[model samples]
Target: MTTATPQKIRQLVDKLELEAALAIMATVEHPTAEIDYLHGFSLLQVKRDLPRALELLRRSEKAGFAPFWVKYMQAMCLSNLGRRQEALVALSSALGIDGQHVGALNLARLWSLELLREHLPAETTNILKTLERLIPIQTATAPAAKATGAAVRADTNSDAITTDDALMMALLGNPRLFAAPLVPSSGVSGAGIGGTISAGHAQPARHPGLVAVSERLMGRRLTVLDLACGKGGVVLDFLLRGHRAAGLEGNPTYQQRPEGHWLALADHLHLVDLGAMTTGFGEDRFDLVIAWDLLNKAPAATADRLLRLVSEQLLAPDGLLLAWAPPGADDDGDPDGWIRLVPPTGLCRRRPPVTPAELPVLPGLVPVFHSRPEAIPLVQHPHRPVRVVRGRNGLPALREEHRDDLPRVAVISVPKAGTYLVGHLLKTLGYIDSGAHAGMGGFDDYRDLSPAEAKQGGPHLARHIGLSELTRLLHGGQFLVGHIPCTFANRRDLDGFQKLLLLRDLRDAVVSHMRFMADAGRAAGQDWVDIPHGPDRLLRYLQSTGRIYMQMVAGVRPWLDVPDMLTVRFETLMGDQGERQAAATIRALSTHIGLQKPPAWNRIRHQVLGQPTKTWSGQRSRRDGLWTAEVENAFAALGGVELNVAMGYSA
Candidate 1:
């Protein structure tokens, strides 16, 4: 075999003669690390054997052929392979090692821009392009340079773009565009390349801020009201998550369009000018009120008003606002001084730039909190009628003032003994977590509404929010779930409130709790030593689980003793749901809530049963004995068997 130096082989490869370069490579008997690097580049060039190419790159690095270009090539190949996250890692690593490697920095900059551009709609993209061109290109007018914008890249004397990363914003003249996410959302696949940008599934992945919102509330489905929701994608995402979400689009074109999201969301989308808004739903209603698109372009004063409206009337006390500021808002931000956040992690931000900007607007995913976010009321115009589109698959759409006549109901589960079963069950009885009918998710916790009240009044005191006190807050169709115990002082606290108490086999609860800890252990670092497990780790888990859940289990009797408390068993709810005990439980709920009769189960049973959530266990207790003798002993030691007896489980 012929011996060819890397320089000789590289000459051919540089000429785009990859086949000849590969033929020369095959002739080498014992290749140097440089030759191996060249060989790997040849493979990547020909779009053949990407894995082997990566292996060769690794070998090159390990065999004293380490160079910054090695990582640059690897990042390129990884990005081409659709492993963008891995590509980012390699690029970041390269930057960490060689900060001035222009290739790696350029690639990262380009990738960030692509991610930002891909998420925005064509209209938005066009607007950005127009703004970008606002600042003229100060390149040469030479014939060759005039043919292309290469003069800027070729020019060494030009200092228009600095190293600090103000490149895009400098050329584009808007910090808002650079405010987009530099990376994809860490844990949200709510939308895709062709879905929602700000709110719906009709665009791309959301703006980084919205993606953060989705990731923050990843699995917990809460009521979402997307203001100025475009194409209803975000609303649709919340709806699919089983939250009763609605969207207010002042423009009717989203409905006028032939997009598929309109079908399921036709009943939920409303045409309105929020300047003069009014609905029967009371204050502190929604878990999230997204003003991403609405407040994004609004002036500072207008944005403040809108933020105030959301904080006061729309947002749940425990809820969050996924906010964004207009680029110009930086000019006169907080003009009216009404912007506030309970906590400000929810502020939107652009991802940090690997390249330092000349004039950095936002470098990392650091949020741009221009003014002190405090709370303000935003009033806007026009109430619109409900318009259900024609193509739904027989899904009912309601126009009543958001179920205001429905009773204020409270659901309390004794730890993991019960799942979110009764909450969904009560939905079958005209309860509204979001809309008029039973939805996929709900029983909005009343505590979330009165956080200050709950904190000041203590646990049981919130449920004591007597009937007259709750009349306006409940607004008829409210359903809340909490962990309030039936105490001596507050046993009568729930007198006017329709109460539900969920119970389970203490043995099964212990087993589930143990399984949860073990599962958690797999991902946890050494810091999760809170659970003390011994040589027989399984047995220790069982004992530990029983001890941990014992307090909640011990408090179950007071709920059972309260005759007004509608006690529902987890086993009965999950097992033969049609069995006598289950039927009796259902009857008790209906009678306790003052419903005329039980609902037709088969018709709405699927909706009531509810789907598995993030916390749902594949090994969730099905029958009995999900625990052991050790666990039973631990429960007995904690005096928790009373709940098992009251729930009618054989001890």
Candidate 2:
């Protein structure tokens, strides 16, 4: 084979007269120039001629050269050019065509904050969540510019930690936008992200005035209530002081504590809802009501209701109300005027009394002694008010910071009687060190999460796990248990790649679900029909129930097999062996995860079973005549037929 010489090639090119040949070759229309220009634009991008490249890409696109990567790169060029809004539009268009394009996802997550700063100022949460979704399915290798709103990429294991921290900081630091900060209740000194934040050396209060006030309040079996107990800081203070403590907070994450028998701890601490209490439980229930500095949180109406509730329900017979106003609250002439506690009688005496905010504003409320202990200092000094509530002003500024070097254990569960009981037992039995449940996730839900799914949804509730608590556990080695919905969103936490696919007798499950839902009032607008027994509302029932099941099963597959899962029949769960097996299983799980069972678990279980003829459902139980039939049909209709057969279903 002979190679053509340059002179011969030139002679051939001259003979062809390529440009003139092309002009003569196609008198008809053709997209040759547009295609050539697109090729050129790609080369320019490779050569770093971003502006010219982008312009060419725009021209190509205008000429109908449709390609996914081209648009995606154009967006990248726009972003590099600081045209964030334009970049977002280009990326959005690219994503609309291909939702999971990594380049677009990276761009979205990397520039989310910057894009947000440029566009919708109010939808910050939406933007952050969007970025949270785009976090590489792969682990990060190194920390990137979190402060500058750039995507942080670190090693996979470390990335989990870094991503979690950045999310927490963003939410907490920017409270104006991210209204809900991910905060956990308490821990065995380790469990979730908040625990990690508490891991550092304790900072003694530099404010001598604040220290004195804290110490003075340590007097007596003080019944203390911490309002809006984020990360349980004040609650921990009460525990340290050996005082009777309780906390009131609206955030669901706080109730999802990592400590074993967490609620038992609450009972021990004397925490109760003063507004929602049984009659004859106790009169003049509390000794002190402390509504710390949480005034400027939300709707003013809601704030006033909280304030008034504290004044009435939480105050003791001769109790004192401790309130703190930020420095900004004192802008009006009277320093004491910032906080005015008026008695019910005093309020009534006023000519047309002013309406109090919050709820159940008592008419007889009256203001008591008002004092300003100028000596107190805050954690972070602002020109703001020193928020501290105590009876004394003389004490040490700092106390020793205590760190608990415990293993990490998470127990997942949806809201159910046995779920909480199991969580209690795990802690008490010394099987698990720490656990949390918002009663949101379903039981046995975490047994099927894949690495990909875990990364996607983990941070949504990552704060529930104390980063400090997990300090000792290996990355990916730390344990988590949850009852989150087995839906597409939470399947990330499932074990392996698939669920164990547990099957219970459909009739029995329906009965149990009915009883459970009635007790919980979880599903909205579910009322019984008027009949001797009852008309079956099985459709709505199965819709919600099956929806959750399908979501879970769909999310976990190929990576995990059904054998790795466990499906306890509802009847079995309540049977004689049920409690024993459940208890034993919890014990086994704790041992597997490295944790101690809480001592209170057994006691709680015993108390639960000891009650005779357990009328647990009471008036809520609506007998359903067709429940069994409807459930049977539903099981056959859904993917449960095979499962039912696998579980040895005959009918």
Candidate 3:
């Protein structure tokens, strides 16, 4: 086959007649080994036919072709086919056949050593001897589109190439050669693989932070050249981040796409040949060039050559290079001597990103941002909102919080309305071991104190007893029953700690509050009601028909964060005290706070368990059916659409 000159290849590419160029090459026999390999490489660039390129190389290998170059190309194909393990195998074979093949050596180092650090740790130290040989390519100086192409031309000189036919055929024919060499066998760790007859040493140790950074950068836009992109994790990171990225691997098996349903997902990826990457891509084509873990695996000169290739062809002008490898030793034994190869600077200094409030600081590399957890405030009842915060990490803190608040009782009274009915029931049921409050300053309703009396006492007691103190008391094993609004967000100082929220349906709640205020004669204050005369009118008119449904919804929001809470509807509790049902829920709360069920089960049962849904309608001459229909339609527009009719509310 007549070997196509670089100018000829350029001309064919310009003309968009790549196939014709390949046909011409087929006609020329025993073209220089370089020509044969370049011919296969050229076909790969223009047509992007990995299979065809593999076949061409296979044929070349059979005809006493360059085995090292052929095997390298085979690795690229295998990597593309999603056969990373196979690709690594081919690269190793190529290196074994011709240790002096710098491109293949670097490619192997980058893939097995750098990119796949998560899988291989021994490759870190392998690149140390090769450090000084790395010459920076003039990629930054070249114009964007021309940079990569220029490097390829420089590296593709036929006279500079070497070949090994035995290595090439082995790579081309064997699928197993494409797999990674680092995979652990049976019971052995990945590092325990016995070395080939000559090359044996301890496996490399991969750095965790580098692996994490690479994972994070995956799917993000990275103008990267894997130099040895092994299994495509680096490129995959860019792709996942919705960036246009590609890779170059020398193993032909690495370049070939695998056969699987997943092939459909890789339709847009471009896996170019290692030689062609230098030969094909324009200068400064990539924004960032990465050569992971390659330093320790290859010879010094080859390592230097690969770095030069990266500098000249891959790196973009303002691009950053993320070089991942093991720590290097300096005068002392500190792990700080990690190195990077740039222009005159040689190695860039590493710095960690600053941390912000409520967030952890990023280490090693400069960070953009960090995140942590937070707590938001919530409104449980009309009066108090709930704010949950993390308290002590153990039960001991809970015990301290509850030690002093035990036997804490909330005194509730009703005037004319039925609020006292609930208080009376609680007293009757032994939930609260106290009588109703004794004062009445104003108002007309249940046995509750007047508005004037409640104001003076409520705030004073709240300040003195403080929620924090109460929480502590509860945590220490005390029984607390109260007539409070369930609003706790207002008391910022009080931590919920080991607490259990108790709630009942809005219908019963409004009815109870109305009566409690009426009996107290406004001692609790008109502030408790949303509107003037609301408590009594609501009690008389809509108590049983869901008239206060909106208030019910508003009340539950605060307790959302309380880890230990038990909710009961008044009507449901009116049924039976099912030991299994109520006990199970109580047990869960007890377990959460590290407590056993209280011995006073029956006494606490009536207060904490269910209650009957109390319905109310005064003596009236109106027929039950008429009242039902009217109440149903009337409350439907308000809050009691269905139950109003069932009770007796008329339209």
Candidate 4:
């Protein structure tokens, strides 16, 4: 009746010892859902025993183990057995559980297209159409010959020209489009169009002007179209508020399931060609057209055509177009209104500019509101504009400052070294309330600023009052956080700034970072999954061109010898043994920051040490000798041992 852990079974499976794995599973008197799933998966994939795998999978499902992966595996088994209908059904069920399951969606699109084409609801027909365009079926003679022929025909039909036609035409027109290209869309996932930057990257708190605009348009009887909608967060927001909203993405890889059944069935989401100068939507079709981050992708010729199309064809006579210029759009000095485009080859080309002033004279459209909103101060484009004809200009400034008597403190740490923990601790101690600004290491503001601008007071210091104004702004309570390397180049900016540098064991830090990158890459459908995981890969990463591990060590090395910098080890504030040390560190930090009254160390300890925030990739064992001998040898070879010892770790 003894049971083996899933990890042990997984290890056996990893080693290709399928028989041993099965034997271990057989020992479990009452095999749990997980055990059944692992056994079934191994049998199906490794042993290729389809019937037995199906039986075990069904049992696993019966035993309450019906996750999306289990369902997907079942569908795969059915497909391999030539049970098309059952496979399609299982895949559909998997999609129902999680619509964006990439593998399931890809399989369904490839094998179950006929079923989807015939059975998809009328409102969801566009989904099938989009899939058809992205993944064309191959013929014996040519893989995409049929699609290419259709595209040529579609392009010739100028009256009924679609986004697809425009894309085809562009590709056909420019023989060298892909050759020596600048700003090429390499390594970018097509899971969604214009997916260059994720919607999550847009911090609403940092850009309240956008939120305000959304709030103002809420409950309006407008038909909205979001061009190049990456992830469709804005469209979803509009839909949630009962507005008619649709998103057009240019990337073929982007796929998402709307939360509501109605939203999913509405066929509001479309996959379109952003590179195309014109979308087939009729003139005066949309009451509101939003092109949040679309312009940068288009070249000069294309941008001009797109603007003309937007002005003359897309917007209703009385409708509004909300557009924001990209980071460096205004710097292009072409008097004829041309802007520079950065292509994939790292070369720049002049393109027709889409400026704010042109909106006023664009046929029927007229500018209503235009301003460089305070929220977007970091934008490099000098003439960055937020223009709306029918919309109001009443959005409150996004930036807010609070002044208090408490001394300002900056908690700096190596990336992935429990920065969040220290920040949360400081927040809990009341050194700074919610009103206090907690930047990502203090360099959050400098991220968009140029190196020269950053050197000259940095973004926050320059944009706001200079260092002299820091006393007024950060009087009673001010805390900053940053991971910027402490080097001679940045010494001027760090001068007069009080800092606490946090460190962790180099070996653990590198492992944590690698796993994090892998997890994040997989979630974003990036190529990080192809990179092998383990000691060899870890060593390769340390020795890679970036030399990230060396940089990390060097970043903290300079600060170690500084008189005023308080150095704290991550291990000291982690786990049961470190609870007392955590309390002491907090006390020391409070004293350093000149807090009026020392915080309740017991309460702070309970909040931070007693219940630490779980690491994003799950907790790793803190036991010594976790690193393999090869990894240790590589670390030594890479000079990590010296850095580790200098950073207070025993060699």
Q: Which ranges of candidate 2 are over 4 A from the true structure?
A: 1-406, 413-418, 430-482, 485-506, 527-540, 543-587, 595-631, 642-651
Most accurate candidate by TM-score: 4
Measured with C-alpha atoms, the lDDT of residue 598 in candidate 1 is 70
Preferred candidate (TM-score higher): 2 or 3: 2
The alpha-carbon RMSD values of the candidates against the true structure, listed in the order shown, are: 25.4, 23.6, 33.1, 25.9
Candidate 2, residue 397: how far the Cα is off, in Å: 23
Every model's TM-score: 0.32, 0.28, 0.24, 0.34
lDDT, each prediction: 0.47, 0.36, 0.36, 0.48
Question: lDDT score, residue 135, model 1?
Answer: 21
Per-residue accuracy of model 2 over 435-477 as CA lDDT, tens digit each: 2222121111222344234223321232222222222121222
lDDT of 1 by residue, 1-651 (tens): 444466778787767688898898888888888878888888887888898888777667545365556765677677778765456545655554465544444565556455435544564554344322322232434232010011123222121122222222222223332211111112212212222223423222223234223322321334567776766655644443223466665554555554424432344666555544433144225555665544544554556556666655665533456544334433343422123332232333222211222111221221232211322111111112233322122322221223423355767666665534565566567775422111111111222233233223211221212222222243335565544434321232233356788777766665565555455442133222344543234345434333325444543445675545677777777655555666666777787775776775555667756454323455565325334566456557655675577667776
Give per-residue CA lDDT, model 4, range 1-651, as digits (tens).
433477788677666678888888877777777778778777766647787787677667544465566766677777777665556556555555565444444556566455445455565665555435544333222222110011111112112212222222121122121111112122222343454422222412122133224322221234566776555545544443223466666654445532212222234555555555344463224556766544444566666665566555665433455644534444546412223322221222222122344331222222222111111112122222211112012312112333334445666676567765677677676654222222212212332334344323322331221222222233234465555444321332333245788888877887776666555442133233355775555655554411434444555565676556888778777743456776787677777766667776775576765334323455653324446777677677756788778887889
TM-score, cand. 4 vs. native: 0.34
Better of 2 and 4 by lDDT: 4
Q: Please identify which of the two predictions, 3 or 4, would achieve the higher TM-score against the true structure.
A: 4
Residue 183 error, candidate 2, Å: 41
Instruction: Quote the lDDT for 152 in model 3.
Output: 21
Clashes of 1: 35
Task: List the candidate 1 regions with Cα displacement exceeding 4 Å.
Answer: 1-404, 434-472, 516-538, 542-545, 577-581, 622-626
